[model samples]
Target: MAPSATAVPATAVPATGTLLRLATAGSVDDGKSTLVGRLLHDTKSVLSDQLAAVERVSRERGLTAADLALLTDGLRAEREQGITIDVAYRYFATARRSFVLADCPGHVQYTRNTVTGSSTADVVVLLVDARKGVLEQTRRHLAVTALLRVPHVVVAVNKIDLVDFSQEVFERVNAEVQQVARELGVEEATAIPVSALDGDNVAERSTRTSWYAGPTLLELLEEIPPSDDPAHEAFRMPVQLVIRPQGAARDEAHRDYRGYAGQVASGVVRLGDEVVVLPSGTRSTVTGIDLGERSLDEAFAPQSVTLRLADEVDISRGDVIAAAADAPVPTQDLEAVVCWLGDAPLRPGQRYLLKHGSRTVQTAVRTINGSLDLDDLHAVPSEALSLNDIGLVSLRLASPVPVEDYATSRRGGSFLLIDAHDGRTVAAGMVGATLPTAADAPTTPEGDEAWDI
Candidate 1:
């Protein structure tokens, strides 16, 4: 194989740049694994030993070229069956950006894996076979991306070589994808045509077709910005631990210090800022912020800092320290959208443990309002949610908790439902309905978006 026009050198050091979290989703045999492998290979991120192993295995199978898909499909079952059963994460870097890419399984049974991989992704790369066009699974993945509020969605029309690299097929598939994405309320949707197997328009432009003009897949990935900046959102922190040194072994300087330790989930915090504790509604002012041994005047989102408040309010592991003026109201009745992942059906009146942020509480499903219909992207009445079913439900919690709307804050609103009898995670839930209702309409951030199809 000839070197790609834009291939990076193996010896080139990875540049320090913005990190992008990306995930791949599509139907089986759509070349997701192959595409991931291509990116890793062209970027020179794969080790020489791994490449040699792939070459050896390809020869044993009597193949002409090394199987690049083997680079990411690390599971034994996946290698034998030629299907991705679990989410495989690969890290690689280019001159412009660093990436944490998750290659999600395409099989319908592994839709739960797709949801889990896409939950916190900055962007989701959805693949569609140029020959198959758009399928039911395509719509399902689009719905999942929309429901999780993934910032961006990229539709890769893989196997363009099989379709003769026709622009007509690419446009048709892209049009259908755009329509479905718009219906599902997915904001940033981009479509690009490429052959993942042949490395055409992947890391570099292919010379096979002179009719098409667009940035390569790698170029797009390097250009797309991260979904959100944690520092810009409202202040929220779930107390993970209370730092109180006791006993005579403690130093005098640390003897009187009492601090709340946790990662700042969103927004910023500074000394003298008024904060309120949830469940108890106690008010306090920040006196100091400690990051490890050093003290700072302020702290921002995603930073693990110990906070010293002026008041001696009763706070614990499950409590939340939020901005006083923007604190979320504590409530026991929660309206949410849940993606049922359990093998057993999810029915109303069933009890489970709800884990939100740093707190867990017993909760019962009060009602199953409706389940989403992937056909037309609408909510239809349903009595129970089966495996891989996405639905809207009402939950009754045993105690009050500070949960925000998922549309506004992803970290503050997302939660998991666990089976009490066993320790299995039954469902992944969001605090508000992801689909449109009587009161809400499908919407996205206001801006003129661009596409490189």
Candidate 2:
């Protein structure tokens, strides 16, 4: 594959400075936290004071070696129980790139949290114990990674030291996971063997494993380019707020300061570019863009900026501004693949609040399609969805919303199902609506009816 404008060649990895978001997923006791700790520790990203605290805590527990997982187990309950309970994020940087690492819990019950972390991840580090090989939870993680459409996957066979760093053992485990990944339509993946506890083949190449020849975990992260650059894609921005200046004096600047504020959802917006206000079908031209007081000729995705249009079109929060020539059709009835995380079973006619980006709409489940059967890695017929169930469900929204296929635009294609009664998020939904056909392949309807899986 060729590198993009900002992507660097493999040899020039350290020369290109970019921010990468990564997440870790595996079964319980797979040492996800420890691997993360190793990355931070070996890279010299950890601070002296923080290291001292971890060491002190380890001594109090009378452990021979410091429990590196203590660095990420922030919650008191997690520390007491020696497990991660929520999504813990850590920021670190090396000479090559900056990173935002989400250390997600591995328990099957915490699968929802893993989805949240991997939803926007550029690379997912999936760990499997060498001794245990691939477990049910490991396959479940692979399924979620495939569903999220993560650009890169690293199947790190951890605890290799416990397995005597046997090359045959590593090969068997890697081959098994690779076969399952291919069955899920994941064509590309990287597998590495490491012992996060011993820091072997994690940040540094291990001498213990002379047979394996591949980039270390840290090297792989540095070399893989970011999934997508927002400027190179379709322009999109969901209006978060409307800025209409209200002041004590009605001056020239104050009277004409009508702008929309939002983070660039994707693509780039330049002055005089024609854009359409979605859901309302209002067309306008970008007259001005400002990052605080600085005037900008163009603004790209991820940058928060205020935009003033040439026409006084009626726009509000939740409205999507997209390129005039290409815009998604606003629809009220939609189908999505959702991972249910509520105590109450998801049934037809169940009402909930659907939050997509800045927009929130009242929604009800119209049909409970089928849940994915992890045993067979297939979607099976089901009438209802309980906790941690991944299924296809149709929704009837109160109003129209602009949506893109999950595979097309991550920012525009993901949503949350919030419980209206308790204001709690019960599910995370991906905008693609797919089903298995008789041909043994995932398919969507033709024309505008199709949404990618």
Candidate 3:
């Protein structure tokens, strides 16, 4: 591999610097771990003792070069089986920015882990083997990335060296990937040619790829902006617990105190700010904000604080405090897109618990609109959804909930469906998205029939 390249000494990037969170996904044996390992090594993020251990293991296995994949496959099972079984996270920093990288498993059975890893990611890096081009797993991963609405996507065409660095092959694979990305409604995705086994185009560009004219993987990662600032959004905070000093052991000054405690989900809350309590439509003015034992005039998103209101409103856990003018409306009927993760098939009329924010309610699937076909990315009619299936469904809730459109607020718009029988997570859902109409569905030669699974 390009061992001749000089290594750059790792410098401590300040914690106050901008942070970027990214996740990696690809089919098994596509060299995802190798790509990650290459980046870590080229950037000098690995400790000397760790590299020595990997080198010793490589020699014992009768290899010429140290197996870089061993760097991220930390589990005992992963080392023995030479496969990733769970999500592996690594934190490192460059002078420009700090990073939190998640190397997710590639097996189909581990799709849930991929979802969990990518749920809050600002960018998702998907790899494709230059020889295999795009496989079914690639399409599946792309669909998941699009559904989650990750801010940025980068596709790395790995193992370009295997094809002798053919420009034609790279172009063909890039075209196919772009086409699939467009079908899935991904606004933009950049494809870069790289050889993860070597260090080419990963941390540093390779001379072998003369035809390619794109930024290297690390460069692109550092350039993409992080997720939007939470303070700029509308104010929202789900009440986790009601705080009221009780009992004789309490201090006399706090004996009559009543405050709502929760983490500010978005935007800012300040003293004298007019706020509304959801589902009850009760309005009150913020009188005080307390963090720990210290009182503050204002608190912003992601900060944990206790709020004292001007009025004695009857608020409880699962209730949301929001800005008075931009508060969400409560509704019982919801149209959503879901990725079914249960072992059992998902069918209409199935009863489950819907957990939205801090609240939970009984919900039923009124209709199974359709499933997205990976072959053509169309919404084909489906009576049921199997494990790892992405589909559109309508739900009827027992009580109204204040939810914003998923496009507007990820925290307020997303929810989870739980199996009531055994407390298993069945699906992840996004609200305020329309179900595909029958007219919008693609037709076969026989005309208007469901696509076969």
List lDDT for all candidates, in order.
0.87, 0.84, 0.86
Q: Please provide, for model 2 over 1-453, each residue's C-alpha lDDT reduced to its tens digit, 9 standing for 90 to 100.
A: 011122222233343389899999999999999898787777766666777687789899998676779889999999999998899998777788888899999998898899989988999999999999888888888888887888899989999999899999999999988988887777788999999988888888999999989999999999989887878888999999999877665488678778999999899999999999999989999999999989999999889999999988899999989998888888888888888888889887778899988899898787666778877777877778888888888888888899889888877888999999999999988887563321343332223322211
State, as a TM-score between 0 and 1, how close model 2 is to the true structure.
0.92
By how many angstroms RMSD does model 2 differ from the true structure? 6.5
1-453 in candidate 3: lDDT tens per residue?
545233333345356368988999888888988988888887777777778788899999999898899989999999999988888887777778778888988988878778888888999999999999888888888988888888899999999999999999999999999998887878999999999988889989889999988899999998998889888999999999999987874698987799999999999999999999998999999999999999999999999999999999999998999999899998888888898889999887678999998989888787777888777777898888999888888788888899888889888899999998999998999896543333364322222122111
**Where does the lowest 10-residue lDDT sum fall in candidate 3?**
444-453
Candidate 2, which segments miss by more than 4 Å at Cα?
1-16, 435-453
- Worst 10-residue lDDT window for candidate 2 reads 1-10
Clashing pairs in 3: none
Rank by TM-score, highest first: 1, 3, 2
Give me the runs in candidate 3 sitting further than 4 Å from their true place.
Answer: 1-13, 434-453
Off by over 4 Å in 1: 2-15, 436-453
Best by TM-score: 1
Best by lDDT: 1
